[model samples]
Target: MSIPGQIAAALSLWIDSVANTVSARLERARGAQQIAISEDEEGALTLRLVSKASKDADLPPVRIGIVDGAISTPLSPEWSAAMKGAIVDLALRPSRFVFRPLELPGRAVEFLDGIIRAQIDRLTPWSPAEAVFHWTPPQPIADDHVELTVVATARAAVTSLSQALLDLGATAVDISTATPGMERIAVHHQRIGGQTGSSRLRFALIAVLAIAGVPAILSIGLGGIVTDSYDAEQQQIQRRIAERRAIARGSQGGPGGSAIELLARRKQTMPSAVMVLEELSGILPDHTYATELRIEGDKLQITGLTHDAPSLIEILERSPHFASAGFFAPTTRAANESGERFHIETRIKPQFGSGT
Candidate 1:
């Protein structure tokens, strides 16, 4: 197999192992009843509820005979009902399984399962795939070595027994064997309800992920297209602006230059009102008072009452900010007025720097 395929298989096996462990813990926490089924030399089966409580010990065992892979006597209704949602521990006669002892360095203990599987064919009459097998806990021996016994039986026999118990409504089945003087060794286990539920849940999760992925992929593609479209539009607008600016620069000597250049030239030649007001405030006499002032383009107008109206024109004409200073209207005084009323207009110089 390819590396990716091998990795995927490994990951799947790990997930299955973790899920089974969690399920087993949850079942134990719920205190599921244990049922023990033992097979005799004649292939007859004995079933009894294994419980710690004293009251359960008085219940009689149910016996059933097996012939040609089928039960000859069916279980009673009460016994059948008790089988549902129970953990069935089935102990087969030792003669049905082959026992082999294996010794390995103590460091190899963690990898014992893989080592036994690889060497199963050399130790037994059947291949690993054709046999259901398990090893007892390792015992430390001399020379830093550990020894254990591998108990194995034909897969067909164990499968037949487990299927029968499942058919009788057992939630899970554990297959084991005990030698004349050795402790019981568990060979295989099956969780009927858990397997079916896990398969359904895995299918549902895959379906949900597939459904959600379609919209996510489409949204990413559509977002890229929209961004490209906006970028193209922006580029086109920038190119048009550049073309317009080039045409304006080329038409500078025509009827009128660009509007921006025209506005800039006007600003340079215009007289600022603030500068004009500042110059006038210093130029005017202390006795003179101005009531109204106006500045338009390069021209300034001042109207006020003063003790000396003629002297105002002389003062303005001498300043660098005023080019031509004169009165646009006649100077007149009213009967109740204490001073002469004068109107003066001036053509301001474009020398904004000297004023500053």
Candidate 2:
């Protein structure tokens, strides 16, 4: 692929990842209830609330009848309301899926998903795109080998069922199957409506493009006006500088008495707080947060919480604005806190643009 095409693909994948992460976080925050719907051999679905504290426990399981690729009886008002914004786990009968036992070296566990996807056509009648499949977690066996059960079904068979649940107001649906004595294995999962990852990616891309286009349009329209204003100001400053330099040369018999010389000398001696803060912000990772920042003369001290405290020293030392970065206080983590509290001290480079 061309560079632009590769960049576009990367941006799409990143958006999808961010969307999925945000959706997961929102789901957790909302405390969405989980409902389990299990299919029987007779094609009836029994819905049960998975939560132990659920008030709906007193209510009996709702039996759903499916016929001719559609729901035979629509959900009642109460059940439909209960299903809204709820995560539904649909467990189909094992008979509906084709189960194949797969054995491999224990080292292949990390790459199980890719390996299974490559072998899907050989293991089942359906191609990878036409099937929804998942495998059980690898179980250790003798001779450094691991075993797993691959569960799969035709995509067409589950599509209608999942759509029916979505129509009943399920926010998300997960399809799975299990044998009598085996653990349940997931087959497919999807968010309902236009809330899927791909949908979110498209929305994010449009929003980003709209944001970026506004700046470009503004720059194009006001480019000449801004440039002309800057040029006029720059010429005025140059003329004044020349007059001051000529006066200094005539009065003092040499240079080093001009305003620009004084300003440059002061800048070289003093540390800029703005530049220090900006440099630190750019150097720190997202997971790190500073609670205290102190600048006394050329020495800088920072107290913060970070996921990895030891790495901060190396990060600060490598920056051009800081030198001799080291921990002044021992790093510690409270039992309830997720990150380590760190205290670090470093010397700030006082000379402006010296690192360049």
Candidate 3:
């Protein structure tokens, strides 16, 4: 390979290695975790180190020790040692950091690191050297644009913190701002030597992979259309054959009209879907969202996600249009932090013209 080609390949391999390392570490950390949660409380910085045990695979975090301004008692030595390879989260008050949002062309996002580094001074109240800034992962918006939340804080504000952490021994350090009712925003982090380079290389690799996958995506899309058309044609032919067979059989067999009328009458006795939906919209909590709703005759099956699923049943049972509101399965946490997935069934109350 040429020198540049070999360099690209090396960068690619390094990027993959770093990603795999971080992913594996995170996976293990989630199972058997120890996080040093640092907070600035009443002008005093405290680090609370905790470990979680997976009891029946549902782990609860146990308090390890509290470090009041970088000092710990009893288990200080244990915590110091543990801090060597542990991920340290330094929490600060919202007033300490300046949060600013920046919108940039999505096309220029590939060079975001460079762009941010260059414009950090202009974007923040401090000089580039004095300010420690970190931009949140770009969120894509309309018109091929992206929005970024840049949190910048003065380095001097946490100078004592840097010495204390390094003295105790910490592998990776992340500084985050904690606000009421909002998720902690990681503003700055200590970078390992290869990580910064790896990030750039990772994006490059993604672009290359996407370009390579374009042809495959196109082929698959075209193939799907052809397959769908063929399937539809086969289905139509099968339906015609079935109808012909039914007609031939109908001449010899008894009429199925009575059975059909009985189904129609049963359908007529069912409750109104619109009334059921209106009741649900009025009674259910704002946080709840239904993913799957199925109505068969008078039986209604609802599968959805919510912050509180148990409360949903009570709300449903209270509604005039619903009865027998209960969960069919256990609720589990959703993929995103949205809430828990719930499966519940209820009986719909029949309305005057609901059956029709």
Candidate 4:
């Protein structure tokens, strides 16, 4: 890509990164979310914690099960503590989960999920849109065969469970199978009832939308004013470049002169400030310092500080462009620094105008 294109892409990435960082920080500052997971009395995955209005009102429930190849009691903590205002992850028992192993041609492995989704109505008791399913990583069964285990559950069950959690004030809910010694994959239907979005996040989203919508709005209301502005600027730049190129070609082989050539001829008839500065820079000593320089007509004035101030007149006179070199002001020694200040004036020869 061109340098400008790369720079613009980098700038856009930086902007988006900064915006996401700000949004994340604002969300974190609001609070850390809590989530609880356990099996209920009905043997279904749910966020309904056994209540405790009194000790006799309800004894805290306890259930022990092997999760991820380890024996850990999932119901020891107040399921209510885990469920109150937090994103909940509920790992249902493997027995409760129905796993269907599917074998198909290897070519369909890449799009296996989409294929499964397309056949959801035929494969499961639920419709395509009403099924919540998770599939294991596809395993190669043979040379041309791929095997996958799809875990299917009804979306209505999850929706009902999530609504029940929301009634008890859950932020979000995640449903996964507690398969023996296997890491859970967050399937297509991870979160239900939507995660709570912070106000800052909403504001940032609105700002992003507004920024994205600006060109469209401008095209409609201002009749592409920004587009016209860019086009006009681009045309002006192209015109100026073309004008300069034409002038250069004319100077080489044409007759009618452009403003640049007219300026060049005028410059040839007179001394240029740049040439004088270059000549002065070449002759100026390492320790010598020039503070100010002035030129009027064919006369030049130099104000400087130097170790040997009175010797500059000889140096200036040695150059053919300068003549009648003499001190304009009395040399004064600097008190704190080890240099003498001197002001000199000289006649500038217009013959120094040679572009060579």
Q: How accurate is candidate 1 locally (lDDT)?
A: 0.76
| Local accuracy of candidate 3 as per-residue lDDT tens digits, 1-356 | 57567446655645575564574355345543345555544444555555533321233222333343344433355455555545566777788787767665555576565556566777788986798777777888765557677778887666556545655665556678854336577665553333554466567767887798789979999999999899679757855664554455555556875455444444444567777777778788888889899999768999887766777888888776778888664454322345666789987865434332
User: Highest TM-score among the candidates is held by which one?
Assistant: 1
Summarize candidate 4's per-residue lDDT along 38-91 as a digit string, tens digits: 665446433334322332234333454433323344543455454455555566
> What TM-score would you give candidate 2 relative to the actual structure?
0.49
Of candidates 4 and 2, the better by TM-score: 2
| Candidate 1 lDDT tens digits, 99-170 | 887766565686666567667887889998999998889899775657788889899888888888888898
Which residue pairs show backbone clashes in model 2?
A: none
The lDDT for every candidate, in the order shown, is 0.76, 0.76, 0.63, 0.61
The TM-score measured for candidate 3 stands at 0.39
Write candidate 2's Cα lDDT for 111-130 as tens digits: 56656776788888999899
lDDT of 2 at 24: 51
lDDT of 2: 0.76
Ranking by lDDT: 2, 1, 3, 4
